[model samples]
Target: MRRFLSLLVFLGLALAQGLSEVWKAVEVPGGICADGSPYRFYVSPGDPRRVVLDFQGGGACWDAATCSPESPTYRRRVEVQELLLAQGIYDRLSAANPFQGWTHIFVPYCTGDLHVGRATVDYGGFRVHHQGARNALAALEYLFRNHANPERVFVTGCSAGAYGAVFWADRVLATYRNAQVALCGDAGVGVRTEDFPGFRVWNPRLPELPGLSPDPEVYQVYLALSRAYPQGRFAQYTTLLDGTQVFFYGLMRGERLPSEATARAWAESALRAVTAPAQAENYTFYLAPGSQHCILPRPELYTLRVGEVAFLDWLRALAEGKTPPRVRP
Candidate 1:
């Protein structure tokens, strides 16, 4: 009986040690969420020189109807404490994940601005704070101060977070001069340049890209990053019939809920945006069939294939500096 009790205690200690390696929620000093709560991020200790920064994905809102306290979109805010306890691809212990053991920084999304909004707007009697850009800058500053040198850095995100990742990739690369960087934006194909005015209120800190229009499309950001970092890698993944992107594009284009035909047209336009950069050697993409929204969070991430190429394998190749094919449906 004593032997069994001793063994049980030993097992308990082992389990606790393993759990300690998982992500822990850390509140950023002076950071604030859209709802006025304190902003926090999850950090799991690993190799300081190798890091994977993942931005949490939730829908975005720009106006009174979407940003109101009672709206459905407002409820999608990510709670960092809850996220630290959940197991997903970002978890270092996930056997299927390639990024295991890398220093993982999970940036939670709650500002409802795709991590780029900078203004506080009044919605009738209520005031909504759109300070995503400031929030991300705080987190990045924290990371840079602590991990002064990084050998390999990957910046990525899904859904709205994907836009955040792309928007911030150049800044991240600039901060770490010698680090080899790669960016993968999943399901963040945004609206056209004509619709840019709606988000222009956010006053995104866009990087300078020569020859592109003053108000370039969102996908154009990827191209600009590519030109800015010729030695770095860039990739995007999405379904050809992604209804989530279609809906957002339509809404930005003045349609509250787009018709099937209208949605298809917008999806096609998004496809063109991604493919244009894929034609460049440093940029690549994987566009599968169906109406699936995001990839990194799905179990299908392990099994989804574009032709004979598995999605996981493709991601692995990209991380290892191999140029994978630009897949299409």
Candidate 2:
């Protein structure tokens, strides 16, 4: 009976695969990786009119110490590429996933540039190609040409990818004029203006905010996008105490890692600044209590709760044009 049940489960998965298109890689000639290989993306078809574009995240590198060939940040690009080729949390077809039936596009990050850089730089003796923005644009153009007119779109990413999603929300909205768009940045908050002096290295053309300084924080970027597109919804999620962000910030500042309590305080303060204003009514956030870095890639994505609402349910409400409660634990 056990063997029979196992057979039944295998058959069920096979049937599901038969109905849904498996993630397939497609190369973009204009997109190039940091190592100079052709860039590629993975696509799994569902309801073409409803699409979920996910940007893959690793770490990022801007200077010699971080971008060197032997640096751990540089190696993350290879790991991210390998993971994108395998079936993982984002590729699951479980009923718990709000985007189970939506068309999925996985944008791999291998440029060591957080999917926003636009230049090639020589770091010490190593030449690092920082063409992340161009690669993303090329893949987006391909989607616009082949799968135009999506009615609903969700742009999301974890860690570095989360920054990409928030940073590029305006461009995504511009590409799909008729779509009801939503942006979710998981574990991508807590970035300060000073943490990003390397922005000059990426040289991305950021959105214009009238009163903001020339170099703005990531939260400010989200605010700017929200005010610019009132018709769209914006959401962000992160652990109250994210060690990964704390470590990254420390590295950028050349200091020891901040305490978890200090990190949580910083996150809360930044979040309040963004969500307190009347103009931020369309923006919401979920801050869970933990030292975890990302929520979307874990089982918590389905089981995690904020008050009386499940995270997945809250996300579904956002996609359905309903304003769910803002959770900050």
User: Which candidate's TM-score is highest?
Assistant: 1
- Could you give me the TM-score of model 2 versus the true structure? 0.85
TM-score of each: 0.88, 0.85
lDDT of 2 at 79: 37
lDDT of 1 by residue, 115-216 (tens): 877887787888767788877887787788878888888888888889889888878878876877889999987755364454766666555556656566
Predicted candidate 2 versus true structure: per-residue lDDT over 1-329, tens digit per residue = 99999998997677556533567667787788887777877777789888888887888887888887787754334334323323334645677678778888888888887788888898767788888898787767767876788888888998888977877777787777678999888887745535566788878656555555566677777777778777888888887767787667656765445655556556666566446432577888877877787877776777888677788888888777555678876
Clashing residue pairs in candidate 1, if any?
A: none
Alpha-carbon error at 148 in model 2, in Å? 1.9
lDDT for each candidate structure: 0.77, 0.74
Where model 2 places Cα greater than 4 Å from the true spot, the runs are 1-21, 74-89, 193-195, 208-213, 256-279
Displacement of the residue 67 alpha carbon in candidate 1, Å = 1.5
